[model samples]
Target: MMLFGHGDGGGGPSPAMIESLRIMQKNVPGLPDVVADTPERFFKHAASRYSGLPRWVGELYFELHRGTYTSQAMVKKGNRKAELSLRKADLLIGVFAQFRILHQNAA
Candidate 1:
């Protein structure tokens, strides 16, 4: 019985990681089911949570208006010190909605 991440170097699942997957599924069932078994999932799920994406995914959303980013790679890998904080996905979605409306004149 191979787990989803067996191809990698035997990385065990983090509870936080699994929770991210569940959150993703609950909100965006239409996208491909990608679990937190790899860096791609971590980046994507974090991106979704942080970025103000409107039912859309990919690089373009990262560059678009209303999108804010907290790069996991930088926080995890870089030397910059910053406070660790995050808004839940539901709150972020509402915030994004507001951002879209407020910034409609600029966008």
Candidate 2:
């Protein structure tokens, strides 16, 4: 499928681009039918036509910006560390509250 747009860098298709596509769709001889369609519809049609297509059951990772991998990994690690720290703090707080309740009951 020919994707005609700015794509991941994202400015979208310009009027000139759309016009060109329209012209090609109408005037191009012996060309395969060119229709601008949503990716979802395209995939759905593909899935319906092709049996035994392997279904992906995980995160759809876009590897477009491979350059940012290290930085993104660092960010993910930081987030995980912070999440663990927060969980520990929550557990400690819960324990302390229980201890305080026990002490008050014993007094």
List per-prediction Cα lDDT, in the order shown: 0.56, 0.82
TM-score of 1: 0.23
Model 2, span 1-107: residue lDDT tens:
77877756888899999998888789488888888789999999999999789889877876785677466888889999999999998888789888774444544
Q: Residue 12 CA error for candidate 1 (Å)?
A: 2.0
Candidate 2: C-alpha RMSD to true structure equals: 22.3
Once model 1 is optimally superposed onto the true structure by TM-score, how far is the C-alpha of residue 99 displaced, in angstroms?
Answer: 13
Model 1 segments beyond 4 Å from truth? 1-9, 29-107
Best by TM-score: 2
Superposition error at 64 for model 1 (Å): 34
Model 2 TM-score on a 0 to 1 scale? 0.51
Those runs of model 2 whose alpha carbons end farther than 4 Å from true positions after fitting are 62-65, 68-107
Worst 10 residues of 2 by lDDT: 98-107
Question: What's the residue-level lDDT of 104 in candidate 1?
Answer: 48
TM-scores for candidates 1 onward, in order = 0.23, 0.51
